[model samples]
Target: MSDALAYDVFAKTCPSRGTLEHVTGRWGGLILGALHEGTFRFNELRRRVDGVSEKMLSQTLHALERDGLVHRDAQPTNPPRVDYRLTPLGHEVAGQLLGLIRLVEGRMDRVLAAREAYDAEHEPVTGRTA
Candidate 1:
């Protein structure tokens, strides 16, 4: 067997942790999910990912590209057009993320009910919970 050490996500200093954070950040997952459908231009991506500011989207794309999970293609046209798509690595990760998204969506009702129950049980005597 090879002596290569396997990556441990729980390790404090593991490089994968940073990558994990990048891939699963507020915008990263959405960006990857959108890209899974196919390539999209910058504006198209922004439109698809509602509520993401242009600055945040640009930053997220740059980070994903740096991590080799996204491919950005720039075309030299009258007006430069940049297209974004998922790399093979990104496709795999996005698939897993989609599964997670679906799971959370499917269970959101349960989560909401749990929250309501917890809030009701923990309601303050003053009726104003911090």
Candidate 2:
């Protein structure tokens, strides 16, 4: 790895932050996870991931495609159906993401318990409770 001099996350040239935002986007993780299962069309993606609007799905897919993580295939059928699948690079990234998700799931209960404990300790007793 080359030694970089500065860290300006807000700069347009800083891909690190943008990449994190892209991967953590609302539909991004789910889209990657869904694609991990197999290739699917736009409608199928929407169906698999609950509560995603068409606009959001389109935007997410476009973003992933631009990032070179997703491959879009458009067939010359009458209706012009398109399918989306993960590129090899996307597969590698998705595998890492899945590992992260699995780790979070495993520790979620402990994390929640810690949050609740902290909140209960910090919160002032209401007049009714007092």
Candidate 3:
């Protein structure tokens, strides 16, 4: 919270590196993106994120929550309900990620072509079949 304290993500000991990893890692990004749509209970979020296992989802959510990007609400009911949503900071980060996702998706054809060309050129050396 100090303006004098600078964060260099590339630095080996930088705390920002951990936060960046939490925000951009596989499960983290998907969790944030899904939460960007709206608030969701744990199971709902799990379903929305598709392939995330319960443990991974729980861990990612905890990390994001600690980073102040995700908000977790626990309601006391006969069957307790917990909901997850993006904080203002989370929304900002998710918005940027969504743009990157859209760009990659839109350019998939070019990406696939490049991959094919690279694979074709290296297949023999790599001992990869097909």
Q: Which residue pairs show collisions in model 1?
A: none
Per-residue alpha-carbon lDDT of candidate 2 for residues 1-130, written as tens digits (9 for 90 to 100): 2545465667777765676677778789988988988999999999998999999999988988889889999999999999999999889888899898899999999999999999999997777652
105, model 3: CA deviation in Å?
1.0
**Candidate 3 whole-model C-alpha lDDT, 0 to 1:** 0.93
Give the runs in model 1 whose Cα sits over 4 Å from its true position. Answer: 1-5, 127-130
Error of model 2, residue 65, in angstroms: 0.2
Candidate 2 clashing pairs? Answer: none
Cα lDDT tens digits for candidate 3, 1-130: 4652687888899899999999889999899989999999999999999999999999999999999999999999979999999999999999999998889999999999999999998776656587
Worst 10 residues of 2 by lDDT: 1-10
How would the candidate models be sorted by lDDT, starting from the highest?
1, 3, 2
The backbone clash count of each candidate, in order, is 0, 0, 0
Give the lowest summed-lDDT range of ten residues in model 3.
1-10
Quote model 1's TM-score.
0.91
Instruction: Tell me model 1's lDDT, rounded to 2 decimals.
Output: 0.95
Off by over 4 Å in 2: 1-12, 128-130
